[model samples]
Target: MRKIPNNGNLKMTKVAYPMGLFVCLFIYIAYIKWHWASATQAFFSITEAAAGARRGQQAQGPLGTTAHGHKVFYGIMFDAGSTGTRVHVFQFTWQPGETPTLTHETFKALQPGLSAYADDVEKSTPGIQELLDVAKQDIPFDFWKATPLVLKATAGLRLLPGEKAQNLLQKVKEVFKASPFLVGDDCVSIMNGTDEGISAWITVNFLIGSLKTAGSSSVGMLDLGGGSTQITFLPRVQGTLQTSPPGYLTSLQIFNRTYKLYSYSYLGLGLMSARLAILGGVEGKPAEDGKELVSPCLSPSFKGEWEHAEITYRISGQKAAVNLHQLCASRVSEILQNKVHRTEEVKDVDFYAFSYYYDLAANVGFIDAEKGGSLVVGDFEIAAKYVCRTVENQPQSNPFMCMDLTYISLLLQNFGFPENKVLKLTRKIDSVETSWALGAIFHYIDSLNRQKSWAT
Candidate 1:
């Protein structure tokens, strides 16, 4: 029958105890995911798992137009890669910070990249339209007009001759103009290797919150694209920047801060392009009189047709070779000599390797094929040696495997990474896809903000 007064602290403990436990559990799980996820699914799933209320993804400036009771935005990015063309439709929600957070993304890819249509730009229209339709379906009809659509062609386009590359861009622009979404003349264009590498670095650092803090150490980025490869990282030592050649150092402004980084894109030295070069096949030039090109890198008994930039060449291994790896290493050394700038600082810095680098490491059993993992620089060499030696005895296997692995190993070594150097090979970091597309969107939004601020 008697009522006792409630002890505020005692009662608060009851509520806070469960709440604190929940927060702790959540943080623990997030830490596991951020540090220990093994591999990743296809592009679609990574974006689906993105947490809502992301930082810096807020409404109006760049993400998208708002609707009833919801802050929704959209950005369409098309990656015109060498092997394929991919479209990324990103949706974001307004968050508490100056930046907005990503909620979900729609991704789709088609084979035989844009470069394949260099001779017939019209053929690229259908694929581009299909990708555009994906954006149309994901974004609400009302937001289409306000949504910004952009397409950035990678090494595939850059590797093409100037006029031909322009033709592809013109065709893409025509396609974008016909679309219902927002369009701009500057939307469709080729992305140089340097931008590709730097953008990827931004995506990684931003996702990991490295750039959000002052004086936070940032990881380096290694992107092995189709026709080119890029390496970008913030150097701890100023000497790294001072000793760099012209155009290797890039200055970037992000979150109101300027960062000077060591970045370089090696044109015509991507895995596939390097393969062509190492095989003694000239880019944009077929063998003389339709003759097959023979090289020491391939198995002596093997011969096949190799397709690159829309040209198919008959290729075979040299018959005079003994010790395939040694010969192949010598050839790869020649291909990479004076081609990629070797940096001693990278030997001590952490790196995130992606694209073909991840694929090759995964396929060779160095890391999880889906849930990627860390690998030593020696893993590539080991795989290359084994694959090359294996192909020599069994010449019926895929020929490029040896060359690709060998090239990756040679490329890393050329970058001054020791055999035991550890590199993180990943597909997704913190549920966001690890690609330049995300960074491209961020840059677009920043430019929009800068323009608006300037006008005011």
Candidate 2:
């Protein structure tokens, strides 16, 4: 027989079972919430720490100080050229009592040079500020105050009227003053042709490791820009110093040493300017009555337009079945005669040609386009003849090739470089640009350091 269960005891057992299950479920949920909250806190902490570290690193400087406690500095150089405006942000490492080493360089270029805004000075601000922004991006914010900012106007502004050039420079100075970089009264000046030559000499010599030691022979510099061409070398012979015409020699003091350099810049003799002169077009002047410029340097069948200094002109080749090279050479001679001062000293110096010299040679396969190569002075003449012949046949190819090649050949001869004289042509050396910008910045920094020492 089944015995009757105790009613009170059964009721108590049912109630306690549900209560115990509820308690266990509540504890499990609490544990999960605690774990999640802790994990989230840890994740946020890690993120904040990483951001703080990055901020600290930036404050220290880009690339920071060297192992020897030497400081790393920066310089911003704006090359206001005839063709374009270029900014070079140079990272340099300096040790006490040693020449600064260019660790790296950042460069960018914009077309329509500073002189393009001669009539409207305010319009040039945007391009100038754009290039400065590039420098801001490449350089760390901490170093901006110490870095020197300079813009050296080349033939572009040199060709401008004195008052107009000053206005352009004053505008640049105003922009520079508003920036974070160091600016001086002389910061934005038209670099004279002589100074331009000397600076280029410094750049080439420093890059080739010639400036590190005393009494080492320095290579000569041949720079052909858009509006002018410069030839500079340290004269070894006493006769060179004595015979050099007035205004052809300049004495430069750099790194506590003086260099009496034979440097000359031929104004209106640059490739582009020469092109205008060759085409019978006057600078800063449009063709008379919009007349077309006809020359034998171009193929007889070619007709086109050429622009220089913001002036455009219609150009065509003369219809003549003549020796193109000879005719072109005759015209180039007429432009260069009595203009270029010939010196025998250029023959003995190991010379390096740059700018249009390199460009023209590379165009005709006379040298490697990228790596650059050596060629004899006569190579230009030979290439000119070949290109002229090819132009006569092709006619539609590079119309200016015949003219440019012929001009370079004759120009080299005018400088006293013989047919067999070898010239090393390159756009860069040791991965650094062969330009006056670097040397200009170097000199400017050196001057600042000297001034600081004197003040102390």
Candidate 3:
């Protein structure tokens, strides 16, 4: 879960978890406290240092534990997705007037997502609490109250009935309140699709150090998951922004800089959801009392059971004479119709794609799963055609691979990427897994800072 730098000569050992995290956590807190030195110092004189000491408790620590006398801090972010729930516990180190840098991350995941327990809110708590325990283990006991813990449910809960989703979040909040970690009113919630896409973009650009550079152009991000897919990028062309439809573009201000980006999330366009749609089945619904879901995208005689969101579906290939690839492509196109917004600027922008996109490419030998690699947009097209044709004849093989690959190809085309456009597929960039959680933590901290006026 933790990615250590290979170039660092610092001696390392297995015992460096909580202690290491403790130091890092204090550094970040000190960084924040240092920023509020003016307000903290003024209060130290007017109201005594006790008040300021309490405010800077986690942010300021002994100098021997930190390099620049800056405190380290921790953030706990839970990614509650359609397929599973995951915990990302991050430790950051920072000095005064400097940005926090991630030093370590402890991550874990559990199956049968929070959404799976929609019918029973009580059943979801054990899983949520298990993830929280990960934070408790890694973070020092004294720092728990200073650490902010949050859980953001994505498409899984978003697709659930509004009341059910809210109930699940409330249950999680109850659990959070019981934990020692700092929690707030905004600690538990369902993330909006727009925010999901934009946060992922922030993560990608942040990792690439593009956001820190004065004039460096940021790369775009494409995140394909189990229940939804997101595409976000900064538009370089003025016309692309001006001519775009509302909600397709969002303005974000971070660290005194504003960025207008093109971002959108298609909820039902994720790989798993696309499989259900292409197989002529509705999400979260039984198919007519054991009726089968038949599609040309599978082996002609292929009949099998596919499980999604803890429900199994009886699925098989159609017996029609229509070309499977042609028909499947058409079906995917229908799903894409009017659901995706495009900007010509994406044609010239570089992109880093992850999640299901990286998984599928890695499975098909199109790219390295771990090391990641670059490929043309046409690579997916090529893989789709071959897999669809081969799987058509070899029905017993992975029948859904063809459909999933084809849908990805078409999805990219729908996003205005040309066949010749190149994209990078990766799970981790620079030893850290690229995800929206990091961006979410930064955003959460920004909000807290605004509340206390620490970011001014």
Candidate 4:
């Protein structure tokens, strides 16, 4: 090779090419390192935020214990409604003279008509144990079967196919062997949430008052559930009313009346109500391209005859002038009122309340809007404006007071009871629905400690 001397003004092309490539490679590696560092920092920040939240939860517990206590009780509850399943786990301590201290909590979601137990129990445990596992790294405590686990299912579990429902229960037992178990309808759950530890007293007051006023020894309570509704008709005795207004009956006359109430858990009612307008040619939308099934409750009504109409639902841009069946299914009280010829006799019956998981209010809101702006309930084509009044009662006295969650009123009429008192209490109770499970756990544990103290 011959070496050629060049002027300093221009470098050779071959030498410049390699230098450019080297610079490009160095820049690319540096960019990747910067991105990796940013990503790593972001991940740690998220983790720290989560940990800080958990620490805040732990700080809410009894002093010298939340950060150090070993005897922690974990309560887990699931309320499966017509719309969805909700999972909640709360950590607490049962210490003397102090409130059941809440240390940690978490939640998860499941379909409305499904059972929580059908899902894997350990997987469905909301990862509370995982958090505890990490906590054990710093604090000294044995994780080997030390914490008590409480888990229970309600409402939606009862709607599953029998075999499936039982399987779900078995799984719950397998996962949570310790702690007392309680299962029942959503009514009791609503009662607990709304009544705020006063469910028993309120139930007693309503039942006795209703029985006394009706002058019947028997009474029936029909509670609407999401997947299914319940009709509980029992023999109740007419007792004395706590207070009676002038011309208002003071006590139930000596009438030993047998109650014929039904808590008809119609698996179809909730779904049926929505379908009626679209199905059965009632709302006149020309049923979508599929098999249209009328709920059993609406079977007779649809079978009788199809009196077609094309009524437009103004609000939702849904036009349907269908027959009565489509519009009426949404108003259950009317269906019952018209079907039962002995309406006069049942008129005196006191107290009707609807409690379920699905949003009855939202469903009816759509139905009423489809009916050109009103729904007919109990012989009244109540304009949509007044629809919610029936279930929750009209908020006319104070527009701020009506908290009706549904368009229809399932409770009773004319009981001479103080409406304001009942409503105020009901609203106060409604406010606690979300906090019920945790509140129940807290209340139950507190009661146990109090009873133990009295004995000692």
Which of the two candidates, 1 or 2, achieves a greater TM-score against the reference? 2
- Cα RMSD of all models vs. native, in order, equals 16.9, 15.0, 17.3, 22.4
What lDDT score is found at residue 268 in candidate 2? 98
Question: After superposing candidate 2, which stretches have Cα over 4 Å from the reference?
Answer: 1-69
Candidate 2 C-alpha RMSD relative to the actual structure: 15.0
lDDT of 1 by residue, 305-353 (tens): 9888888999988897878889898888998888777889999998999
Superposition error at 296 for model 2 (Å): 2.1
- Model 1 regions more than 4 Å off: 1-71, 94-97
Give per-residue CA lDDT, model 4, range 251-352, as digits (tens).
111112232222223333333232343233333244455334343222122222222122222111112323323343344444334321112223334433
- How would you encode candidate 3's per-residue C-alpha lDDT over 93-150 as one tens digit per residue? 6565555677788889999789999888999988888888889888766567778999
Return the top candidate by lDDT: 2
Candidate 1 has a TM-score of: 0.84
Candidate 2 versus the native: TM-score?
Answer: 0.84
Q: TM-scores of all models?
A: 0.84, 0.84, 0.84, 0.38
Model 2 clash pairs are: none
Candidate 3 Cα deviation (angstroms), residue 104 = 1.2
Instruction: Encode model 2's per-residue lDDT on 119-191: one tens digit a residue.
Output: 9999999999999999988876656776789999999999998999999999989999999987888889898
Candidate 3 regions with alpha-carbon error over 4 angstroms: 1-69, 395-397, 454-456
Q: Give the alpha-carbon lDDT of every model.
A: 0.82, 0.87, 0.81, 0.35
Instruction: Judging by lDDT, tell me the better candidate of 1 and 4.
Output: 1
